[model samples]
Target chain A: MNFDDTPEQARLRAEVRQFLAAHHDELAHGDGAYLEEPGHERVDELRRTQAVLFDAGYMGLTWPEEYGGGGGTNAQQAVINEELHRARVAGPVGHVGLGMCGPTILRHGSEDQKQRYIRRLLRADDMWCQLFSEPGGGSDLAALRTKATRHDDGWHVQGQKVWTTLAQHCRFGILLARTNPEAARHRGLTMFVIDMEAPGVTVRPLRQMNGHHSFNEVFLDDVVIADSERLGDVDDGWRVALTTLMNERMAVGGGGGELGVRSDVLVSHANRLLPRLSEERRVLAVEALGRVLVESLAARYSGYRLQTTLEKGEHPGPESSAGKLTAVRVAHATADLGLRLLGEDAVLARSRDGDWRWASAAASTPGIALAGGTDEILRNIVGERVLGLPPDRPRTPAAATATPIAESR
Target chain B: MDFDIDDEQRNFAQHARDFFSEQAGPEHARTLLAAPGEAAPGRRVLAELGFSSLTIPEDFGGVGAELLNMALVAEQAGRQLAGPSLTTAARVAVLLADDADRLAAFSEGRLSLAVLDGPPSGSRPSMDVVGATHFLALDGDDLVIGEGRVTLGEPIDATRGLGYVELTSSEVVAQDAQARWARARQVACVILAAEGLGAADRAVEIGLEYAKTRETFGRQIGAYQAVKHRLVDDWVAVNQLRSLVWWAAWAADHAPDQLPIAASAAKAYCAGTFETACETLIHVLGGIGFTWEHDAHLYWRRAKVDRLLLGDESEHLAAVATCTLHAADAAATGELQPI
Candidate 1:
């Protein structure tokens, strides 16, 4: 029941603080804005920073030692992450690469694949993005129409992937395409490591409503991928994809301070803004701020519960969905409170007097529910998986006839 | 580094759950409700479970377990709609730790003490004190245990009636009664919150179960997004409340400086969550949930009462706000407080 760190964890925390302090000037400042900002120079600097972190035994701390990780517990990794976040320093670059892609490779990839990819991914030599969502299949990801036909030497993939975050910056992507049209929706798909530079593959950035080029629409047309690049067996993409998606939820769900504005920033904003409002509005403002604070605490503590699960050497499952859902509510509440505090000034576009923070939050926070998984989809996961509720629809006839995915896993 | 209940605490909770299920379950609560003042059953089981002595020190003839350990039992008590017996005992034992004979008497069920919920200036309402002989109330800056005359009000939760009391004769329990009373209040908050958390957890489970089994329009109602998502939100709130209860319990046992803020947060959050959970339970249960026969109302009543007991949700939120402003970093870094 103790929350204090162990002696070993404390020592690691001190070391991490010292290391972060040493690289304070070189690190990305201001709470991970650089991770979303796409530029060759920014990415190059990020790559070098990641390499330095990997060298310092901070990156991939919880991965197995055989794969060049530090072979440390998640708690130790958590201490480093907390210190890094508190210091406003950048962690490993290419979050998709390190958090989702690298972990998928370690768990479901072949020995050769693990050997070739794990270290490079950790060091950010090859950045990664997920190409799971398509224009036809956002929440219904299993219904993706992406086709990957077999070839003599490799597989040729052709699909349009929407909401491909950081695709323009990524060198590779974990693509889920239908390798067998004859099979069930979930069964026919296959996961592959598609080279973003392959011929006929195009990455066009999507301008977000907040005017950030953080998302992309990747068009894959006759893109050739080597046979060895397949992440898992043919027609078993759903199982492999689950591994990556679970990690994505874990990252997004347990990802505190990474997703939303800090509560303190909002508190300060309230302190500054509340004095100008009417008595009625001020009371409403205080209530809104308090609600945000409460939800933020819920998100934070639930994240700790997730951390404790990882610390106990258990893979996070649907519990991560709850954290993700709570995190979204916190973000939404903060954004709503932000706008409420601004009064009529909230309608003004980009008022340089720090009013933009709230406006930007309002714009960007909605997209968070869309990312990782939609709020509705996540609730389904929490309801079905965590609470053992029945699925919304009966299994498809083909799925009913086929082996249950749970059994296959 | 472990921020979870250990196996011993878990076992204690299981034991509490088993005992409550066997003795003080909703059916028993209903029975007590039917017969107004039937001396709420299960005092022997409560004694056997050692709940009364849970927070009392060894010098005071008690197990001297952490407040968290007792909180686990409190959660179970809430789940079964067990009355406020343990809540009262927890506050009494903490406030009367210096009085060993009184602690033993309370533990052995020879003394029945109910905590008064009001200011020190005047008459206070002692909740769920149906057959209590004495009351622990604030007497102008001092915590006093006194033989009191009661005026029982029409309790919303008839299973545990509410009563107003006037101190007929009194004695200060401790030297530093005010400070000890503050600690007692914090302990009460955590235990009540834990109980609310348990009640919320059960209420959600009841909804989920009904959702899974009950069919509407050729499908399980839970299969629909509207019902299922609402149920999921209930589940999420229960989980969140569980985190707060654990954290507040931990703070009470290990971090006194952090206890006030943590306890207030737990109490505040637990009120809304528990109330929401009970309401969601009824809604998900559909028609059966609204009936007087249904156990959902018991939880609803408890949540309504618990919310305003130590302090209402808004008051606790205000306290949390003040604490956070005083130590702004505590709210930012949720767990990393400077001990």
Candidate 2:
């Protein structure tokens, strides 16, 4: 009910704002705009910037100090994120590694495993991707058919992972492979920290409709991983994956980007079209304006609620699915409105003066909807978890097992 | 920090459910609907149960409870699809609680009241407000409480008239004009929002159960992509509505300064969400949901009436805009923090 930050929280916010302000000029002058572009050069630049953040004690603010983190609360981390987002600085490119994989490893990885990877991940010396979903087991991940047979002093992994973001740039990955087909689908799986550069492993970039290679298809063929790389006990991979997935949900649900876009952009679009718009078109434009206002307010309130929840030490729950769904819906709706407001000019993808950059950004709406999880999958989560609806009937074991990994790979 | 209700609130909600289940059971509600004209016995039952006295101040010989408490009972009434006249009676009691004299009459079961009018253009009464000892009229800027002769809509029995009260004021019981209008609007918003919340809750419960049990294509209809998506959307809407309602109730209870903004947000969000939830539930239920014998229509009717109770969607939207603009102006002038 209380929306204002506490005194201590307010001080922390001020500190974060100060830090962002100090770094703002440097970031704005450097390869900041290139952060959203998909390229290895930008990834490398981001890694260097992440190291600077870590050196300044801002990276891993919510993580325990034993793992090369600041050992701060989630609220502090959220404040850091909000400030960084406000400053338009590119966030740590190792988000998947630090936020999800590293956290899972901290919970379940061996001491040696943590010692070797945690510091490197924080420093951005190494990048990571998730090798969980296969061609056949995206949503139904328990049905994965990836196999990792035992080998001398190690394990031989043979599988393909698809839709892995920045896999081509990753030095390591958290891989899920079936170690025992005799056990139940969930029980037989195991998690490992696989070296992406190991023999017989290949990563091919997959260009999305937006012409970005932000994701890739990873092929693991007889990729040998040391025993030290195993994340948890054999056949406990599903539990480890659960930890990563939970973090993934929170990270995705954490509202990012500009909290609210500039109203002037919208006003300018309307002003440019007001004279040309027909009477009916003007009416539609006004209605769209009303919708934009309501939706923007809704999104802000939702973000505020989430910020409050984080401040209270609650990890994002199934209710986070609502935020995810609303975010995508609002984005899509806003983008559509922008397109309509821009008339024929909106169809053009590129303009020499960047006048249509907003429209071009809107063009990536579908990709955003499908990125973290499909809109449909998010709905299922909301229904089953948030609403306490009954779980979907279990797919038959035979049919589930029959799914081919190649399709996902 | 606490998302779940406390033990006291939980017990209060449970007691409310029990009271309605016992007193306003399916058969009881059916009887009320079939006989909307009768007011004496129903009013007596409500007064004996202390429902009508909920909002009255303790000095007036009534239960002095917050609007939140009233909202709880209203929600339960909604779940049972209780008759609108009874709801209107509760609303009137809430409105009259601010006036010591009216509260005294309501506490004594001497004030039989109802909201009997429709929108501006409608000639006939949309709700049963007959046989009231006093009728409260909410004009644009005035509240006129008067004793009047009313037309009965149908026969609930001899003592009640399912009818509208045609105002024939012999005396002005209370007149605050602007203040009365604001109070009436707040009460209307709370009651209507609570009703919508109730309907949305029931629709979700029924839809989820049906999704689990009803099979199609060798799996529960809920297992289908189309149905699952729709059900999930309804779930989201329900959550949003719940949040807005609680915030609204809290504002109405403690922060009257924020009441205008909070109440409009609550009503607008609830109206839209409840309408969608009801429609989606019907679709999820498929052909069985469309039948007259099904209970879905009860919720649909309640949602429709609640949506229209206090200025429909557009009216609420305008209210939202006005409040938002005021907040913006205050923020600009450094009178309030920008939210």
Candidate 3:
């Protein structure tokens, strides 16, 4: 109920704001061109920025010091996020690593595994991507057909992971494979840290609808991963995946970008576009403005709630899905509105230069909705897990029995 | 920091549940709902169970409990659909909290009071005031109670049809209008929001169960994209409303100063969300849901009625605007102004 931060949190917020302000010029200048490019270059710049944050003891605020972190609390992390967002600083380009994989490893990885990866991941020396989704296995990921057989020094892994964000540049990845087919669909899976440069692995960047190479199709052949690289129990990869997925939901669903984006920027955009509109278009524009205003307010307050929950030592729950759902809807709506504002010019391409740039950005949103998790999948999760809805029916025997590789194509 | 309920509130909630279950079972609820006019038999049962005496001070032979305890019982009653007289009785107790003689009468089960304000539709016929032992009416700053004929509709579960009460203010007493309105609005908002919460929760359960068992297109309907998404959306809506309701209830019970904004927000959000959840449940359940036998209608009906009971969404929104902006105006102008 109390919206204001505690005195200590307030002081921390001031410190974060001060730090970002001091580094403002460097932060702003470094990412200028990459801001419009949805590719590994921007990600690399982001990683470099994260290194600066890590060196300054600001990267792992909520993680325990024993795990190569600052050993702060969740509230402190929220404070840092809010401040960084306010400063318009690009977050860690290795977000999949630092936000999801690192946290998952800290919690579920073996001590040796932790020691090997945690510090490097935190410092952005090693970038990571998730090798989970395949052409066949997506929302129904438990049905993955990827196999990993036990070998002398480790496991021989072979699988194709699609939708691997920044995989072409990633040095490491969290891979899920079928370790025991006899076990239940969920039970047979195993999690491992696979080296991207391993002999049998190939990462082919996939140009999405937006012409961005943010995702790739990663093909893994007879890649050897040491037993020490396995996270958690041998056949408990599902559990490890759950840890990563939970962190993913919290990180992505936390609606960080939505909160940090300046409302005035949008408002000014609307005002500039308002007078150029036809009467009918003007009405639509006004309605769009009102909707965005309400949505922005909701986003801010919801972020405050998340911050408060973290302050109270609670992880973001199903309720956090509300924030994500609202954000995507708002983003889609705003993007659509922007297209309307562009009117005849919206379809124009700034470049036949064959380079991915901001002019081609409008197409990225539908991918945003489909990526991380599709809106449909998120709704199911929110309903069933968060709202205690009934479970979906199990897939039929034939469908269930079909391997993901055979079914996907 | 404490989002979880404290030990005392938890215990109080548990006690309220136990008491209401024992006192307002299905049979009692059915009988109360079937009762006619102002002098229903359930009044004695309510009095015996200390429902009418909750707000009365200790000297008036009442338990003198917190407003939160009353809210808990109201919520449980809503969950069970335990007749409208309980809400009316609760409102009466709130109205008579500072009136010593009325509190004594209510405590001893010798007098009964029915709130003259009808449902939010504003279409109720003038109430018959003759039979009521006392009629409570809002007249500016005064609560005028006199012998009058009271005509009431049959109660159905936790809601009854409109009652027309004619009052003769033989004993007219003046109180602070704003204070009375504030107290009355708080009680109304809490009870109505509780009812909406109960209906929405039940609707989700019903829809979810139906989705699991019902088969369509060689798969359980729950697996279908449309059904799952709708159910999920409703679930999200219900949970959000639940959060707002709890926040409003807590504010009303503990921090009266914040009641105006909190209650309005709670009422506005709860009414809209609960109604949406009800409609979405029907769509998810499809044909069978529309049938009266499915129990979906029970919640749907309750949500529809409860939404307009305290005040509709628009009313509350206006109230919020008035409370927030008008108060800001007064403060800015350095003048004492009443909304």
Identify the candidate with maximal TM-score: 1
Candidate 1: CAPRI quality band:
medium
Q: Candidate 3 lDDT (Cα, whole model)?
A: 0.66
List model 2 lDDT by residue over A207-295, tens digit each.
77666788789988888988888889998898898888777766664442221223324444555555688888776675565455445
Worst 10 residues of 3 chain B by lDDT: B119-128
Error of 1 at A280 (Å): 5.5
List each candidate's DockQ score.
0.62, 0.21, 0.14
Q: TM per model?
A: 0.93, 0.81, 0.73
Candidate 3's C-alpha runs over 4 A off are A1-56, A75-93, A123-125, A145-159, A178-189, A196-213, A219-228, A233-236, A254-365, A378-409, B25-71, B85-187, B207-230, B253-261, B279-295, B314-339
Better of 1 and 2 by DockQ: 1
Order by lDDT, highest first: 1, 2, 3
Is 1 or 2 the stronger prediction by lDDT? 1
Q: Write the per-residue lDDT of candidate 3 for residues B1-339, one digit (tens) a residue.
A: 233345786787677667655654334433433454332225676677786576567887787775556666666665555554455655666677678887788777788665666422221432223234666666556665666555555433333435566554446555665477557766667666765666676677777888887887776787776788887766755655555556566666566776776676667767767778878888887888787556566566667766776676666665654454445456447784322
lDDT of 1 by residue, B1-72 (tens): 577887877887898888777767777666666677733444555665577678888776677888888889
Clashes of each: 0, 8, 14
For residue A80, give model 1's deviation from the true position in Å: 0.6
The TM-score of chain B in candidate 3 is 0.80
